[model samples]
Target: MSEAISYIWLGVLAVFEAPALFSLAGIGIPAPLVMLLCGLLTGIAVGATPGLAGPMAMAVSLPILISVFGVSADALLPVFAFLIGIMKGATVGGAVPAILFNTPGTPDAFMTTLDGHPMTLRGTPERALKIAHFSSVSGDTVSDIVLFVCAPFLAVMVESVLDLPEKTALIILSLSFIAAVMGASVAKGLISVSLGMVSAYVATGQGFHPRLTMGVEALSDGFPLIAAVLGVLILGEVFKSIFDMWRGIRRKRAEDHNADLAPDGLRPGDIRRILPHIGRSSLIGCMVGALPGVGSTLAATLGHSLGKRRHETRKGPTDKSFGEGIPEGIAATEAANSAVSGANLIPVLSLGIPGNAAAVFLILAADSIGGFNPGPSVFNFAAPEINPELVVAFGIFTLMALGNLLNWTIGGIFMRSMGVMARVPNRILLPVVLLVTLTAIYVQETSLAALWVAIGFGVLGFFFRVLEISVLPFVIAFILAGSLENTARQAFSASGGDPFFLFRSPVACGMLAAAVILVVLLARKK
Candidate 1:
């Protein structure tokens, strides 16, 4: 236990002892902390605006951040902290648009719009925004604590027994779980997952020769990872927004030029009334987020539905229920969604599987940066010497806590004042985002082929969105394809080319069977 505490202490000091971004009054300030603040503010602004989101900002900033930071081991903490801050801040800022202008910033925030806009209409916009910020930050803090406690313990336990075959089965299980629980139709989610696996396998896998490449020199090297990801996530979003606007599916983002209502605040009674909803929603969100591809949208929906049910039961159907501008409604939705930010990291940090888009970027950061490898091995406490990856893991935890601190202190004020950002026309924002994204890709790859790959994937993403298919399964599957293939191949080799190698281990066989059962059950239910 002392050893563990010693490592944790080192991790905490590592962040404070890092190279300073600047010196103030002869005291050096850490770069990671500064970047966290900067990213948090930027994320809040982005979330306040319509047609922008945390993942979009993350996709655009990643390549540019890499270029500036140079992918050094020391750069990892600062770079990842900023992304973490953006994710945390966006959860709070997303409520701004949903409350003040009746515009949900992201799909999950649609739950917020139910009671949020009603609050604004009833002349309690300030109170609505404050409720969102407080609940978001509180839920985020709870989830972060869960992450800090759970990830290392789970990683260590998994490391003790998992072999190549077991790991292979686990990856298959994760993909299956993601496909089964992700979208409206289990079939559509499976299709998305299949497409991603196919895309990821092109021109890359185990073996001396690249099997999928069509003899083109550029294809031989395969698609640029960053470009493909950004194209699908960022460029695809841009193209879809433009297409929607052109097709009249989306109206121009005209501000509701209504009178500024009097400011309101959350009284003690209000806090007392909303606390239970926030607590329950936070628990619900954490549970959902621990499973890969079960996104915050579902969490928000479940939180709101259950909160409403409980509220109705208590009020005897006569009191002001949910969707009637009650603070509990805002508390339920915001807390549930925001809690997903930290709990989503559980898979990324412990299992090396990304549960969401934010986790995807974090895994990408670890891969691109090198040095720090995430997985069960990362938490190896019996190492004869210090484990650097373990230190980095705890440093990430520290940064996350700092982000929550910022959210608690100044987030409400900033979010309340961000009502004007909702009016910044998407017409002006979309083109700038497009150009910057393209530039960031080129600067990273320094190749025209990368640009073309991004455009191609972006088109594919546009269609996927149009078809109402979930992108989470696709993105998660694409990222995991290589890991699955490598583990399977190694297992096969170890079994002396036995095709039934994965079944040799009872645990692995049971896991694989469970995966199949999950698919069948979900498909039938859907």
Candidate 2:
């Protein structure tokens, strides 16, 4: 117990006493805290804007931030702090446009629009914004507490039990599960996964003879990871949005909520009215976020549905019901989606699996920085001496707590300042975004070919969006491909070149069998 307490103390000290970003009047300011605020503010600003999101901001800033703050071991906390702050701030900021402009800043914020915009139309935008901010911070705090308690134990448990083959099978199961759940049909999701895996595996193999290089020497190193990830995600969306705008068929607006303005609206006491909804939805979001590949959209949907059901069951229906400018609706949706930001790290920190796009950026930051290896090893407590990773992990917890503090105090100010961002049209916004993204990729990799590969992946992403396929599976598969391949190879060699090495252990066999069963069941369900 003393050892544990000491380690936690050391972690906190590391964050405060580490290298500073800059000095003011001979006093060095901690880099992590500064970057956290900067990222959070940036996230809020972007999240309030239509056609921008936390993931996009994180993706764009990553390369640039790496350049500014060299990839030293000390830089890890600050970079991670910034990314996490973005995740938190964006989750809350997305509610701003949904309420004020009747625009969902992100898909999960679509649910917020149901009640949020209605409240705005009725001349109580402040109340709606307050409800969103309060509920979001509340949910985020709960989730952070849960993550702090759960991630270490979970990572340690996974480290103790899983070997190479078992881990390999687990990855297959995870990919299959993600594919099954993410899209309209299992087949389409599997196709997306296949495409991602193929892209990942191309030009990757032993030494001089890389597989699927197609006779191009540039292909020998494969596409740049940053370009491939951001291109498919950000640039692809840019293209899709531009095309949609050109066709004069932009995203359809929600149905009109101008009718039936209820005089009796969100009073200060209404916080009590929405408390139950917030509590339940926050739990829902945390659970879903912990599961790899499950995202904030589903959390918001489920929370809204449950809130509606509860309200109907309890008070019947009224002008101020779930979708009609009710505080409960805003509370439920905001809490649910905001909760996902903290809990999504469960998979990333514990299992080295990214649950969503924001989580993907977190993994990317770790990989690019090179000091941190996020997985079960991150929480290995048996190290006899001081474990730097453990200390850093604890520092991450401290930064998260500080972010929550910011959310409670000034986050509402940022959350409500969404109106200005809406003025920037997609025409100006998209091209600028694309230019910045490509420029950052080029600068970081110092390879012009990387830009072309990124553009190619962006086109592929555009197709994925047009076809209505969920991109989650594809991104997750791409990220996991290298780990999966390496683990499988190690397991194969350890098993004396056994073709069926994955089924050698009972746990591995069970997981592989589970993957098959899961796909079969999900297909039938689909």
Candidate 3:
């Protein structure tokens, strides 16, 4: 224990001296700190904008960051610090618009609008935003602590017990769970996952022929990950908002702009009353966040519903319900979603699997920069030489801590400022967001083909939303498809193409069985 503490202190000291070691753009300050601040500010602004999200910000910043940092091991620390900051900051900032204008910046924030906007309507927007900030920070802090403690143990356990077939089965099981929980109907979710698999298979095969591309030269290299994700989540949402704004403008239904900022007069008694609810929701979010593909939206929804149940039961079923300007509603929703931001890293760090859309971008960034890969290997305790990736992961945790501090110290002011900003007309704001997203994709890919692909996916995504089909399954499937194919092929080659080899492992068989059962149950319920 003493040796471990010394090593951690050494790592911290080394990080403090990293600028000297790496020559960080001739700046005296450490690059990680600089990037963390930049990402935090950028995330808050982006999240305050109704049509943008954390992954969108990540997709846009990643290429630019790699260009600036020059893609070395030294670059990884700063880059990841920035990504971590954005992840934390966006969760906090997303609540601002949700409270003030009923315009959630991301899908996870959609639940916040239910009670948060009511608070705004009741002239308590400041109090609502304050509740969001405090609860979000509390939840995020706890989730990060859980991730720090649990990731290593879980990774070691998986590394010891799971073989290739077991890993593949686990992925399949994760996909099944995601499909079961994400959409209104399990069939639609499965269909979306199938489409994503098809998309992933297109032009990405290692076979003699480029499969599923139909000889299209532009698709020979397959879809760009950043562009595809940005298109689906960011541009798709932007296009829908644009259409909505146009309709609203046609109907002369412009939002009533409010620029006055109210003070949040939260009492100590109020904070004490909400602490139990925050702790409960944070734990719920942390558990869900650790699972692959079960995202902040579900966490927030569950938290809100559970908190409502508790509130009603306590009130003897006669008092006003949660949606009518209550701090408990904001606490529940914000706590869960913010908690998701930290615990989502558990799957990414321990299993090399993205739990949500934002983790997908982080994995992509790591892959593009090419120093580290996430997996159980990352947590391996190889004694001779240290695992640098683990150190970097710890460093990211530190940066996340800094982000939370920023939230606690200055977040209320920032939230109030965004309340004013949220009143900006969407017609004007969304166009700029759309332009930036397209420009980001163009910058990263440097091909008009990528832009066309993004546009196509944007259209597809908009339709998916309109049809109430969940996009989470599709996105998760697309991101995991490459890893799945590679792992399965490796396992097959080892088994000399014996398809029955997967059944040889009890773990693998059990996971497959679980997947089948989950699918059957979900389908029956649907």
Candidate 4:
């Protein structure tokens, strides 16, 4: 405890001191870059081990993180707050490649290709990248503030006397929200979610002890979250691309259109144009992020769609030209996606459940190393041992803030110069990514079986992509499956199997009421 407190104090001093160092005139270095490098170095060190992942890094570093400078939960709060900023910044930083070279650094940046790529075709790739970075940063910062203010008040209400049944009901409500908010059709969303639930059950050893292992000893340990995510989202995308290539969907052009690039910098007017949509996109992003299964892709798509819809409805006849390489599309998508980074952390920090795939990996890593669980108890019990939870949180926030500032300050310049990155042959990139993933997984358990499972899931992920199903639901379901089951068991035991115990608590009853209201509203809309 003493050690944790000391680290907290140290972190606080750094927080105040960092800005002063960053503000030194003509230093030409941005604060966020420093934070990103710190996070990256930390991530590489912790993530470098075979079995280690992000959460594990946090857990393992907990003792040192706490002891180094008298860190404690309260003291670390600013650090975590700073991470919110870092995540937001990083999300935007990804857009640089997406616009300049049609390569999306992050999955969520895929939508930026629609108009951003076109802007590149029209010789404004740098401008498009700049707009994306600035708009994304603006949206993320604004959304973080909103979440910081609202999460506590929301937690207060949620913490009030809730029993097991009500909590289950609330989970149901969250699922329903996902169904309503996801994809083009309710039917498709339902199907995607159902598949995810099934996958979660299979991976978690349900029904029988050591379930679905097929006599493989390694399978008894269950699936690795990171491997699963890589398989489903990243590897899956890769497979889909391969399939597309097999079917002759590959682009044949080789020449760089803007070979002699003269990129434009973002003007003050550009920032002003995107400011109005930032709040709306950020709110949407946060709400989606807080809900499990809904990721940044959906958030960006929904934000853009809504913005387009609103514009079309307002313009009527003039709306025909609405979505053609417009800045609004960039603003809406970036804001929505960036906002998700912070909102997603809410459930991870407060509930111990991961809202998306990356978070799920982080959670598993944390459990393996920190000896901490990712739920409400973490804040109370683990805060002593890892008292620097707040510091870590603040660290994340600082990382995000610095990340964004760096992206805004140098993203355009770097993107313009780094256009060659996009031209790299996919043949090389794909294999390298696969090799890294395999090496990472092998280091964790040294099990060949795990590698096979990852490959299998990679194939499965590809199929899902082809079917146009959302992979986020599967990730969310996987993270929550155990919690839902455990909570149900406890509720049943407490109620002596009466089932009424769920409704007995005021908090539970209120949750039930809210669920009912949401269901009614969804039904009415349908």
TM value for model 4: 0.73
Q: lDDT of candidate 3?
A: 0.81
* Pairwise lDDT winner, candidates 2 and 4: 2
* Counted clashes in each candidate structure: 0, 0, 0, 48
RMSD of model 4, in Å?
A: 7.3
Residue-level error in angstroms, candidate 4, position 22: 18
Which 10 residues in a row give candidate 1 its minimum summed lDDT? 251-260
Off by over 4 Å in 1: 206-208, 251-263, 316-318
Q: How many Å off is the CA of 62 in candidate 3? A: 1.6
Model 3 alpha-carbon miss at residue 443, Å:
1.3
Worst 10 residues of 2 by lDDT: 257-266
Q: Comparing candidate 2 with candidate 3, which one achieves the higher lDDT? A: 2
103: Cα error in model 1, Å:
0.6
Model 2 per-residue lDDT tens digits across residues 352-465: 988889989988888999878888888867798888888988899889999999989999987777678877887899888889888878887898999999899999899999
lDDT of 1 by residue, 47-97 (tens): 899888888788777777787788888889889888988898788899999
Assess each prediction's global lDDT (C-alpha) against the native: 0.87, 0.87, 0.81, 0.58
State the local distance difference test value for candidate 1: 0.87
